[model samples]
Target chain A: MAVEILKENYAGKVLSMTIGVGDRAVTVGGATALPFHSFEGEVGNRPLIAYEVLDTVPEDPPASLQEELESVWDDPVKWAKYCQDEQGARAIALRLVSTDPDGQDASPESAAETVKKVLDAIDIPLVILGCFKEAKDGPVLKAAADAARGCNCLIGKAQEENYKTIAAAATANGHKLIAFSNLDFNLAKQINILLSQADFDINNIVTDPTASALGYGLEYTYSVIERIRAAGLMQNDAMMQPPMFLDLSSVVWKVKEVKASEEDLPEWGDRTERAVHWEAATATSLLMAGAEIMVMTSPRAIQTVEKTIDQLMA
Target chain B: MLLIGERINVITKAQRAAMEARDPKPIQEIAKAQVEAGATMLDINIGPAEDDGPQLMDWIVKTVQEVVQVPLCLDTTNLDAIRAGLKAHNNEWGKPMINSTSGETVRLNTFMPVAAEFQCDIIGLCLSGSGLPADANERCAIAVDIMGKAAEVGLPIENIHLDPLVLMLNGNQEQAMHCINAVEMFQTLNDPPMKTVVGLSNIANTAPMEMKGILTAVFYKMLVDAGLSGAIIDTLEKDFMEVVRTGDPASVYPAEHVEKTMKVMRGEIMYAHSFLEV
Candidate 1:
């Protein structure tokens, strides 16, 4: 199929970037053409997948993912290092889950330690996520952002309430920001506008329109993302123009269908294979719907999704 | 100044009949003609009818979007219709504008979410449940309230266009002056400047026939002087609209001098002058 060159002016232009001290570099912009339409226009770079590594062990990761990270799950730096050094991940996303108020309530210092260790161990780009608890994660993300200063990492889950402080930290430290809004295009545009008003360079902003698992409102998420992309490319709305990031791993890992044992549902296939396919399928769906960056957990799923992207690009 | 075409409404009998028949071809023609006549947006108002409002609105929105590239302001009192219109034409190039709502807490609570849900701009009226204020300060307060509600909903202030309720001048002679002051006050009070508009003909409503020309000219000048960005008026009247487009010069005497030099272009006026000379 011939690709439609959607945005001729902005095609292939890296959104923006900041030079890291050593190898912890990141490029935020690059859309030579629409997502996965490489035949018509230049898709300068393939979509980058960040391997998800959490501060604490995931309560119930799928067996496939758990087995792969077993040797390094105890140490975040080792885990991040293994994903990059061995697994060929383009980026590493460290989820600061400990900062959740209901969870371990980890301090900013701990989050910062994990960030520093990951940045030191791997030269690839870094994406530092918060625990989704605005109050607790706000300060924790700020500390991590400060610790990773000058590395030009992407820090967020910077929601509506706490975006001001998080955006300020990223702007001050020369890093990118992830503006997350619930599954609504208006909220996404509104947050982006608010952040831009606060003097954050829009080029450094990435939108996260909150994804859902395959059987759980995935169609709604797809429509919202597609609308956002259409508004950006067709309407030329600056607020909705940022490349999107779909946090696929979190959405897939938490679902019952992905985590349940095969014996629990006799008709279902192998639990490990089913879960990995679930993550891969969800990530692939998002890619088709214009997700520029995706974060996933299972190594096998990442490989499968990457191969699919390659075929689509070809 | 953006001229939002306001012809497509169910309030008029003709429009209601057209909608009842589900004949959007006439609506599409009206929209096309309005765009040709320089309408920046087509304000679609499908009022409360016995028929399904949302379904009708959806049909109109889709038909209009399919025909024209210009955007449509989904104007309706029915929230369901607004939602349907938004859903049907989700990916249009222009951001649709929600016709209006007063700053009353009830209205804001109801409409702000819809505006946020559809990612469209909205027109805010400078009046509340207490009713339209008589003075500028109170009107500005209402504008501020509406803007505050929009901000609370995380909608940018720029997305709001404030309508400083344009009251007629026939009954109250000082109404036009008060409306002008209200517009100025609202402009000064808004943080991220908002576009101000008024229904141009509203100021002349119920005025004497001979008084309409004078009233429209004076009100147009006053509103323009007070920084009105747009007005809803009949754009078909080329002469009146030309005067408006030309900024309503202080003296037509000097305009006559310029018009005579460009006589061939000024067909009717020049022909009348030639007849008088003959």
Candidate 2:
């Protein structure tokens, strides 16, 4: 007897979304099937990985990053250009960590100026992420969104505590918005619903279920992404249909495995490769789980994920 | 979307035997399994238990409730069975719902009053003494009558879920679009909005076994897009559940299969044994 191969027939599709303008504008999502199940349906575009660029040098920069691009780490414009021109990054995610009141406490005007500088240096799409301090992000993102207006950049990370100002800013500036929820399917859906209810165009909205690095609650984040994707495609839920965005760098860099030196744990092999693998592994796993776009650190890790995505798409 | 598990109906041989023997084990096991498989409600169907409906209905209601606490929909042509089920129902989950009443005057009169007295949700089939309405407008006409009659009986219009009635696609292909249109019409019927549901699997009846899954899932997407509120479906099918939960069939199913299903549903191509094979 011949054994039959069973296949799933999904009724819904993830919204294929495009960010930026002109030739460098990248489109993600629009999956007709689960990630890389192209034998059954259309998988539209390959996942886009954006290199993470910080507005200010981190207090604890990863050694791998320090060894590679120590020259441009302090300058956002040089850093973005290095990623775009040298590393061949598909997109750039500029984290305005300096704007947090608890951190460098840079003013919104300065953040906007930095955004203009970065936009001028790179032709690829830019994703502007705010210092997640709810109270501070509104004004900072509002200024940044206004500065990037008509560039069609993706302005993010509006959470429940402070979505109104950020969503309004993104809408007013004609930029895409990323609605962030704390690793729960219902919360993710609710934020998108709230955004759409406020007259923000549903198509331009991207969902962020919040990413966690490998071995640190990544499974929970993975499940939420799968559920969000399934709800968008299988349940045809309009609120959950937006392509997903995962921020992997922030969580990946903080974990002990990425930070521990080779001297401290000689059995774990080289510190630099170990850290790069940690970031690459996390990104690869989430790609399988339906992350349409991701923000990643470690140039080596981004290259590994890019090659993996090419093979998977093939 | 509301999913009422269709597995417990007595038309199936195993369930009919279980209901006849008054054995609660098989029936309760199925009930527990369906709830675990993601059914928010279950249809307890006794197919015209003309001889002992009242006793069986009461027994089954109490029996199924012992295992699962989800809401139940009492399904039968026997009027006494519906009353018996309600009388024995435990509302820890929710009040029991009537499986159906039609636009036929006698059925509307008999069940609407019972539905109102017990304050239960009811499925109002858009059908009459003459049989299923020919098109969406005719179905809407029957729906209006059913709504008006429910009002006259003091039943809340909100409690009535209008079913536009799905027909087998092989014989009645055009009725599929009419049913979808009717669901869209039913959604705009009232201010707070009336609910609409369908027997989702009915559209695939008599289709090849291989084709049933794709047909049901694709049509389900259409119904959901039309603003359907619920469906009585084979909730045990994992892919079907995925379709119901995600509401997108185009992404999971093969491109050719989805397109073929669409062509058949739209009546662009006649349904045949080779429809999917081609």
Instruction: Please report how far candidate 2 places residue A170 from its true position, in Å.
Output: 0.8
Model 2 residue B152 lDDT? 98
Candidate 2 lDDT tens digits, B1-278: 67899899888898999999999889998999899989989999998999999999999999999999888999999999999999999988886789899999999999999999998999999998897799999999999999999899899999999999999886577799999999999878898889988988898887768878889999998888888898998878998888777777766789788887887687655454445543
Supply the global lDDT for candidate 2: 0.88
lDDT of 2 by residue, A211-244 (tens): 9999999999988888777766765666777898
Worst 10 residues of 2 chain B by lDDT: B269-278
User: On residues A59-109, what C-alpha lDDT tens digit does candidate 1 reach at each position?
Assistant: 766676776778888888888988988999889889999888897888899
Show model 1 residue runs off by greater than 4 Å.
A1-28, B1-278
Pick by lDDT: which candidate is best? 2
* Cα deviation of A171, candidate 2, in Å: 1.0
- Per-model DockQ: 0.02, 0.02
Tell me the spans in candidate 2 whose CA falls farther than 4 Å from its real position.
A1-3, B1-278
